[model samples]
Target: MQRVLIRSIFKLSNQHATKPYLLQQHQQEARINSISCYYCVYSSKRGQQENDGWGKSKRHFISLLTLGIGLGGIGTAYILAKEVSALEKTATNNDTHENWHKERRTDLPTYKQEQITKHDTLEKRVWVTYGVGVYDITEFIPKHPGSDKIMLGAGSAIDPFWHIYQQHNNKEILTLLESYRIGNLDKADEVSTEDMGSPWGNEPKRHPLLKPASERPFNAEPPLSLLAENFLTPNEFFYVRNHLPVPVIDAEGYELDIEIEESDTTRSFTLEEIKKLPKVTVTAAVMCGGNRRSEMTEVKPVKGLSWSGGAVGNAKWSGAKLRDILLAMGVESDEKRHVIFEGCDLDPTSHPYGASIPLSKAMDERGDVILAYEMNGETINRDHGFPLRAIVPGTVGARNVKWLSRIIISDSESSSHWQQNDYKGFSPSTDWDTVDFTKSPAIQAMPVTSAICSPSQGEKVQIVNGCINVKGYAWSGGGRRIVRVDLTSDGGETWHVAELEQEDLPDGRHYGWSLWSAKLPVPSGCKQVEIWSKAVDSAYNTQPESFKYTWNLRGVLSNAYHRVKVEIE
Candidate 1:
């Protein structure tokens, strides 16, 4: 049997290269050539048997590898509400400029139909307005909360984007919009990505403690894979993680200034030159540094976004290797320990989001790190750091800075608070008053971690021999493999090892997450069974049971125990 193995779902940073293994062993004469096609072990389609150590986990990883078989009818139309034929009437009689406007007008205006949520996605158009200036909201309809019918107008407009919703737009619309806000509280453009701290996308919209990274924030999340369906979210989902406003980095005159103290040289790579490097594709995940931060709120009222695990995504990243370029520019190695990355945006909080890796991690043959230009096969969107972004695989989301303009190679780490005081794990008893930021290094590669992404609490499970099967993912930090995943039914008293899914990735790093499943046997005398599981990395690191022990005032790196309870047969 197979268990889906999921390592921490975010991306992993490292490097690896392998020769493709041949599927067929025999060679034939140029003309005699009639050999049957054979499946090759090294085919891009072949998955490794890395999870064999955990027999069950191996099965799951192998079976589910099929889940990501390949790309299909992508970039195709997914319009749901209503279909349109030709314009009710022909184009305007005006032959020039007016004709273009006619081509853009919709044949049908209002759509009031609802879509069936058969695939867990609304898959229909929905509409919302700031004032006027209509946009096709089809892409955002599924992510909204105004009820299914509200999505009908996704391709058109209902008015309210710029002008405040007065009598025309009331409380019901406001409430519905607020609920599906993906979390932020204000108008998406004006609040999260705005600049000037104005009522709309503006500069100076810095947080009470932050500095604007740019004049405008790119508020998008890149896709999780290279498959066609991820066109919108490709390698770059314009980043929107601003305590402030978006930045404005001009594509024409922008210069990437990199300082390498090793060779005592400073070099610059024009936006054009950097994009020309030999390209590489990486299927990696980038997660918010504050993902699932709300779980900590359960124990105490923390300050950051109470995000509940939706802040991360995966993508096929293509860019230049920072190390290769550094070496080419004569980056030196002496008294130095690590290399620090700085972003174009800076916040007053002393943390505009940054992280670092062992200089070795950067120079490793497997480190596929890069300064990305394209996301999901398209030009980087404005919301994501257009022009440039650092793709640090399998690392914290914050380190993958958007709108990047600076790169420094030195002996010290970054000075940003995110790379210093926050994003770390402290002792259980540590509190704001006594916690020492220096005591904990900024979090880099994460720890062996797992989460129940689906099957919410109170959800029913099938019973077999008084048992229920549990499924989830497990992952570890650095290059450490998840050696074992133990599931405890009834809290911490007793446990059983869950099965593991696939084990290796195309890049040859066993770093990708593995899905898992376990048939938990019901306790003989208990009314209910509480399920909890912990992952052990190759280095033997395991997650703690509660955030109380690991919690810091900043609420960084909360890899505590994850527990779920269900009724038993």
Candidate 2:
């Protein structure tokens, strides 16, 4: 088998040695076509020899060599074959090479660091390295959930970017990436994981009580039982939804940049300067757009962190009101413009997290937008955006950019990936391949949502006076107060109104969530009961009966009837 492999390499080299190194585009195309044809014939021949165990291995070896020739030339293919033979002879069972040498197959072609860099352009080809594997992701770029952000890893290692967006660090994504693998990276060119220090090394300590949805970017929410225990969620128990490592900033040296795009004027304000401005406190509930994504996944698999009912929290945020600051700066409000907020937390490419709200919302007296420095009457911690943060009351949490650094007034919306591609809703029938992000507007204010928190799913409950006590929280966005909460103990067959503890804010300015409790009647001789809750907002908007119709690719804005099953005692 070894002699045959060597002879094949020499024969291919001789055949291509006379060709003048494929400089023309037509010549490259012809070379690729010929190599592909050769691969098909070679594979068919190997398929016929099923009796020999070496046939399958030989086919993989030939496939890698042909891919190399198509990518570079015959000389590159020769080098790749030699590297594979060398690896097979000397590769050990160490942690570094275990995955690469799996299944006793070490015939994967190898490419140099510089060779991978040359294929960076989409026109040429898009290649990226993860560990020792090199993948051609050009075909997958358009289908990437994060949109063109995947291009940032072109001609480079995707390890760093995965460090920021840890959701991609899963088996399903790995399997998809493996289908695009064309070769392995040369061992000499491999960068050890230890050498690439962790981006999350500076992350702040978090409360142990918070249940994490992910650990690297550190997304977590409070336990549902503890969520509605108080009207104002405790700072330590407040849910955290981070997209990147928490940025470390010096509070004393912090500066917020304010940019006016029309005039191209920029101004900086120090922490002290911002503190000098009049401070206002607004009690608001910030909820993740995918708060109930886990439940949606039960109906159908969705793409996002699997948050339960605890991703929403109410707090008193204290900071300089955005309207007051804009007025003092002599900025003119235009409804057609947008107020963009950028966070200091950056991705692998140094792009800060950003989002935008309409200028009308920023300037509206009742909008209640603020550059918050305190939460729940205490100094904001690093996990919650320490030095400064944007508090866009009644808006999705994505728009409330934390680690607040810059504010831009522009005529257009933010160009951030989260703004343009993510955090948007789509039709239930719209799948990932057919979904057009631009067609759907970004989620701003959320709809009415309620959940049953106290009984805890699958817990055994004792019937007291033919009724079971229930407690949970209900909220709506855009200052649309939750007007009513209804509970059903028998699959919506009958309903009982829940008594709500609501804030005394005026109409259209009720930003905080409402805590509700009820005593639901249980049917006689029942072994189990399913509890459901739904809320009605000020505009009479109520949650959908089920997540089936509300399902989308990204699972944002999933406000369905919250349900939990319990065993009757």
Candidate 3:
């Protein structure tokens, strides 16, 4: 039987070598594994077959069956191990090859020529460029959060679409993209003529969640959801209401000029010299006077940047007290006088950005006003006035001058347009053509205001467990604490008290906003819920019941009870 098996094997091999049978597509890879296993079993059972052909056949059959199972299992294990090792080696080599190409690509030609190198179709060779960096996003494309949206720019410049989908402007997102960078973009590529006239041409990147009110003067506010997350807003997420392009300043050369009209002395203090003065810290909320202007516009057309309810933030400011500085300058406590602040940021006319508060507000011992260089524990960023700025704790945001370059103590108020004409309140009967700027005073402390951040305006709310969650921030200017927040889903027909994220202060001096949240039961057959929130401050001040009576031409001081509509789907 052994001799026969050997002769049969030899004959089969010769026949196969001369005219080999092709394997089916699926069996191609496993054909060798099967052939090797048969050879291994037959070789191990060679000596077991003995005696006459019939007896040998019986013995060989039994032996072959027993050894085939054991030897086949061992052969399969060996093949699997070999295949895995080969795969690992191939992956290592591919990674090393990719790294080498990345290093080489870094030294390649400028972005002008390289911008055309975007090739995203191939599995392991996809490439794209954003800003000044070229990246190999082949592996990342499949795992991208935005999925196929990224594929639209697979082999092309993604900047145009990135501008529209602003979420890509985030620092964490940029850093993640940088990890895949293969090269730097060319520095010589001129600005595309198509985008030259765009208002956002040279604007600094902002947090994508912010709603833009204007692109030229650069005003924006964070989403209300983010505004109420922390007691002190992160500097990056803070509201920006710039009247001009943010000034580029050098801290080493930066100076704060203090001009005293009474003393006829002008003193200039460098950033370092200003730091040497006694430091003080204060926590306050800076809210734009135009906050919620859009709500007022619903009642009547108003003239101003179309701001929403997010143009406000609370932060910790650290700097030298303005009162101390005034005392050092020997300023007289006169109510008729004013303290003016001028920012380095200049408008198109080259006029310095300026505003002023009454001398009493500036000199009040408890006002907590300061020449702030730090916001929320870090040096201010360029967007929020780098090097130095001013913080007026309980005043309108316009009075908190950014990039503070000069401070003037004078008997007259700031003659800047922002002070004399803009940022002042007007009567509801006043029209743009019939307005008298002199009749109204500049807005100082804000009115008690609250806005529902969740269940956004015109949002569809799912009835989860038969209830909906409502959340918002409420605060009053002049350090007035929010004592109560009332919420209603039936258009003020009934009200439920919202629980504050942090309990209200016993001292009734909470300057920052209170994050109020509550879950209200949905009425059985209600197809729509008109959600409303109104806050009561420590002074018993509450937002007006209607905006019709509060509407003004400039849209300042629009503190109406906030309303949002939600459809029950």
Candidate 4:
């Protein structure tokens, strides 16, 4: 029995380090401990039975106990150390990109494709080469955190940003970007490392159409008129609001780790593994919580990205259901309150992008939340989360996190700064000095909103037969449908019912926008026309007539009636 117990300890030690090298070292320690235990037990028992040698037996017993305890302790410690080292090695090997080209360069594109891929304006074919690799980035241009700054590399090399943005130098970014890899750049055309000096010097080219908010962590929106041109906003024209520089992820190495609150086990899923699950496609609109914030500044100079009405877009997304994945991962149906999502993108301050949604909303069969890999029928581009992203339909854009890396089912909300300190609403009396974020809940489902896209602010319009045409988009959150759109040529005194263009969707499932147009007669002999538009939803939600009563310190949820003035010269 004693020998069997010692053998069991040795067997346990072997389990700690399964790697051949570490296992060998651990086995050697186990053998020594086993030998010592056997000799000590055998000698101590034999000495106890000899009555005439009592004095010597006492000394033997004492020594036997010390040797057995000390050697057992040493063996246990060595086994633990080896186990930890093995775990560290696994993480290191998974993330390293050394010799990446030699191992994963099979499907790259040629030099001719790189040159012809430039000029995305017509064919909408955007490609860029980085370190002898080519990537198609057309889908990412509009959703890019820097907006059109990404366009500067269209049909060209990414060397300019690579040299200037020090963050892109790491292996994680190189691996993350591999998911978008289509082909290889010809060796001769690839920029040599010696010649790839920082030419732009941290300054990226700004998009001509975007109104600059801040130059460094680029923030901008397209001109208001261009935003209303299409029901589905073009990717390039979509407004971008970013809190950090974008992160590149190796598509092959990407994993979405889910922490099951019940089991306390973090299970990992690859992008391909997620793709194989049952697919769900949703058409939804994602609008920034700060969309139309610039108008709120008119009430008071509030602090935030200066955005107009252009900060929203509708897209079709395809991916595995978040609810399905969570259930399959063994999370108890009743265990969580909020489902927290974390993105791989990190700020210099070491904060990863994060948000949380109510568990009720996340698990609702009709909620349509997904771990999306494809946007608009194509694989998601790198700038917008190449391998995977979370699409929470009809929610604020911030909650629809990009570069998603983790899904946590928990009883409490996320502790992220974005969730705790920002994106919440405040009363009209609230000011920066006296405001408390905890007093108000975070802004979720956006309020009923509409924006005038045509006859842009301060434009001249020709009155043909005393009539002027007006057009724009209207949408509401919480699955509410836009029931009516009112257009006014004379500032709400007399309203014209605009004809709404929309798809025939099921009842209680309207999540996209409605493009409306109306031909309203110009007031007799007026030199200028003031056009105002507001939409009414099925729930009777409508925009405020003025922004003054609704203005808050953070400049959020600006849903006032959209007004544009045009001269009738």
lDDT of 3 by residue, 168-255 (tens): 3443334344445555544442212132122133346788877777554567888877776786788878888876545555577667
Tens digits of per-residue lDDT for model 1, 1-569: 12111111111111001101111112221101111111112212222221111121111100000000000000001111222222223322333431222122232232111111111223422233222111223333332212233333232223211111111123322322222211111121211112111212233222222221122221222221211122123332323464223444557666776776656677777788887877776555565655556677688644344455445554556677787787787654444467666554433111233456667667766766778887666666544566788877767766777767567776878765456544676665654435565777766676667665434465555578867777766666454566778888766777888777644654235545555667877677675667787887777889888866666544556567766766644
TM-score of each: 0.55, 0.82, 0.64, 0.64
lDDT of 4 by residue, 334-359 (tens): 53488888776443222356889887
Compare the candidates by lDDT and give the number of the best one: 2
Instruction: Tell me the whole-model lDDT of each prediction, alpha carbons only.
Output: 0.46, 0.72, 0.63, 0.62
* Model 4 worst lDDT run, 10 consecutive residues: 59-68
Whole-model alpha-carbon lDDT for candidate 1: 0.46
lDDT of 2: 0.72
Please identify model 2 stretches exceeding 4 Å from their true place: 1-105, 163-170
Better of 2 and 3 by TM-score: 2
Error of model 1, residue 471, in angstroms: 2.6
Off by over 4 Å in 4: 1-208, 332-336
Provide backbone clash counts, one per model.
80, 0, 2, 10
List of clashing residue pairs for candidate 3:
111-186, 132-185
